[model samples]
Target chain A: MSGQQSTTSTSIGSRLLDWSLRGYVVLVFVFIFAPILFSVVFSFNSARFPTIPLESFTLHWYQTIWNDPDVWTAVRNSLIVSVCTALIATLLGFCTAYTDYRYNFRFKSAYLALVLLPPTIPLIIMALAMLAWFSKIGASGQLWSIIIAHSVLTAPFAMAIIRLRLNQMDRDLESAAWNLGASEWRTMREVIVPFCKPAIVSALFLTAAVSFDEFAISWFVSGLNKTVPVLILEIVQGNIDPQVNAIGTFVFLVSMTLVIVAQIFFTFRAGKSFS
Target chain B: MARTNFSGFATTWRMPIIVWQVLFFLGPLLFMIAMSFFLVKNYRMVEAFELKNWEKMLTRGYFWDSYILTFWLASLTTAVTSLLAFPASFALAFKVSPSVRRWALFFLIIPFFTSYLVRIFSWYVILAESGVVNALLAHIGLGPYTMLNTKFGTLVGYMTLTLPLVVVLQTFALANIDRNLVQAAHNLGCSPARAIYAVIVPLAKTGLIVAALFCFILSFGDFVSPYYLGGSKPPTLPILIIDTTKSGQQWPRAAVVAVVMMLTLISIAFAALALAYRKRASR
Candidate 1:
């Protein structure tokens, strides 16, 4: 009876320890996320100073963010860049993945490596390199320069996703189409493209998210013209205002909404594909 | 004639793709390499090649110090992130219900969606002297320590950015482990801790390595965290390169530093990839 009681007490003690560890993990999660949460909550604060104690909640910062021309312009620029980057990256990624997967060619490994290199390269280095290259030919600080840089940075991710989707596809379908006297172009358009459309869409959304959130590359490449990230830097460097929190809150909402939507779409398609 | 026609069509189609790959991707790298070797006068690569830039870069005491500091920061970030992320990932993978796990993963990934700059800005509100941590510290009767403009601030900022990645990757790795192997170990009179250590860890070692490598690379290459959080004297190669570039008098020397940083990064990446590939092959 004594031994059993001791064993029971030991088990209870270990269980308590396990629970405390779990609690610690949860606390760490809060530590990681609390800043963003504070930003979101404090965006509604009436006070101008972001760090001041909370007064009555107000929507004034949101109003200010809405009325600010520079904020809107930055948002518009980010939207334009992200959309263009997504479209170009997705199209190029599709073509590359299709060509590589369909045709057995020499120098395949080298080509793949070249395509994969940019995403893994340090962003600052790539940014500096792009700056140097563009400036040498006298093309720095242009909107199109930013667009091209974003495309280059995001295309590899698109290619990787599309490649994975393509690998899962059966080559026999393409061969059968060709055997039926269908032209290669027709087969790709009708069969391969349709099969990879879901992945292509996911790639577009993912690339857009990445391009929109990108700062290091954009900071170097964006001269004169400021994106949202650049604007955030300017705000933090210059002022400690509540409007920045409001803007951050809006950005957080938009990005999270889009990611959630994309994830749902991806999950549904992935499930269907597997089923 | 028919065989020749087919081959000709294939060649024509492949040519543009190859050209795009070379011009857009390989061209910049080659240009960077060449510029690393050439002297820059008035922001243009001079006709004469010189080892002066390399020599100057090698001799700079600050350059070597920043490199060491950068590596140390990255190693610390990787260690902290892995230590924190491992248990969290294990909990999500094995302990949590599937529905809760889904929601947890979603929450973990939400920060990744926000602008990196904005997220870093948010940290200022949390770590500043008058910030959240300090406020809490004061409430508890502890003196409020300044976190911003210090190495601790930089470390915390880096941890915030990288911890999510470690958790996500480790969770994916742990989820992929064969459950039966773990169960078999437990059934064979092995304690849960012993089972995890012997069977689960060895199986998940590759994923952990990859996660650590990702954190290391990201932290090593990071300039913004230190720039924003480290106040006046940030010790990082990227910041050093930026400062050198802005000086306008040391273009060639800056290029040499950039080259060295790139080479170090590439070798590390190459080694990690080789290790990952070897592990995958063995599996």
Candidate 2:
């Protein structure tokens, strides 16, 4: 529909558009990772302020956090909370997913909706509700309070991941196990669990990462039992410290490891299920 | 495997989780509502049904202003992030290879697992008056501008938080579209821009809208961006909730704000869900 000259002009224009799109994606990636890169790079900056012309690379800040007892306390608290939250959330998620897979009762839609509803609400409101409820029951300001809140926060995610795996599972495997005279418990342990192994592992890691990185709700309900993020917030509240960059670096590396591990397991299952 | 074991099986598997959600999730929500009506007698909540908390919070002009500001910032962030994410999503969905798409998704999703507080903090260094932006700008005699603790700073934080997520959601929705239609549009002498606006957007309208809705919901309820970055310039709703509790142990007043926020979110979610799924009239 175009003459040769016009076609060349359009092709050039389209080529320009293509390059810009690619460039835009690159810029986006740069923007997404810039703050992270800056924090990581400045963590070891011999200079105190996170400014340009960063001084010789040094581990002074990292060493500082290493010696800080408060930071250590936060690390311990976060570890216990994330690990406990992950296990509980995963177990609850598995049950919820299994319920969806195995049943077809009335109010099923409502049940599923409530299961997936937490992520949609803002964290501030949830934190408020959680804080009030915790206080009423004399459970506020404790490590377990954080765990309970985080489990509720993260279980839906675990349920979502496991539910996907359940949907992809071959229905016949379970029925076959049943026909072979395996008990329901036996079939669940042998057949369903194995099939969902990748998803379960992935969900555990993902939920752990989420609980580890979460801040607002943890801050409200964490009380004196501050997680790493809460500790970081206290440091950076009105002042700047290179210590935050060091702590941020540590938190960043840990969360990244958890998420990458989860991603690997998730994709491993995807490759298996599709092919 | 007994037929009569259905109830046992259902109860065994489902009841614990149902009870857990009801007790922890739903129970807290109900308590929050009730707590709003409880009397704050002698600086401690007492067992009384009163409207003082509601009256105190609702009658304040700052409360209403904060509510409006929160809504405005959230809506603005949604518009900005969605538009900003579109071109990258378009490229990822249509222009990139499968391997590239996979890598892009992985990279985009990484930020979500990282500390959002840190993400906002990263901007503080760059946007502050004596910060990196000004230092770089000194060469050209440009901005030593006031960027931090401003609306601009808050918007930047919101964008940083939502951009990666919106891009992931949009790319996912866009990638799932039927490509043949785009090819057909191309054959009918439509430009790439024209084809995207007319054909692709309508096909992916529901997903696009839902992604925007998520951006709005997250930004609306966010406390960190407005407090740390915006410097609480007349406090957004979430910031006000925090302040209320901090000032006088006004947990009841905070609960009132929380209830209002929840009601707003629920209604908005329902309306958006309806809008997303609404059918278009045929020509």
Query: Can you give the DockQ of every candidate in the order shown?
Result: 0.46, 0.77
Task: Kindly report which residue pairs in candidate 2 clash with one another.
Answer: none
TM-score of chain B taken alone, every candidate = 0.88, 0.96
TM-scores of the candidates are: 0.90, 0.97
lDDT of 1 at B37: 72
* Least accurate 10 contiguous residues by lDDT in model 2 chain B: B1-10
How would you encode candidate 1's per-residue C-alpha lDDT over B6-116 as one tens digit per residue? Answer: 676566545554565565556666676677677866666674567877887889898898888888888899998898888888877777678877877877877776766
Candidate 1, residue B133: CA error in Å? 1.3
lDDT score for residue B100 of model 1: 76
Winner by TM-score: 2
Q: For residues B1-283, could you state the per-residue lDDT of candidate 2 as single tens digits? A: 3777767877787876788889889999899999999988788889679999899989999899999999999999999999999999999998889999999999999999899888778788878887788889987999789988888899989988899999999998899899999899999999888999999998888889889999999999998888888989889999988888877798989999988988898888889889889998898
**Candidate 1 to truth, TM:** 0.90
Error of 1 at A122 (Å): 1.3
**Candidates' C-alpha lDDT:** 0.77, 0.89
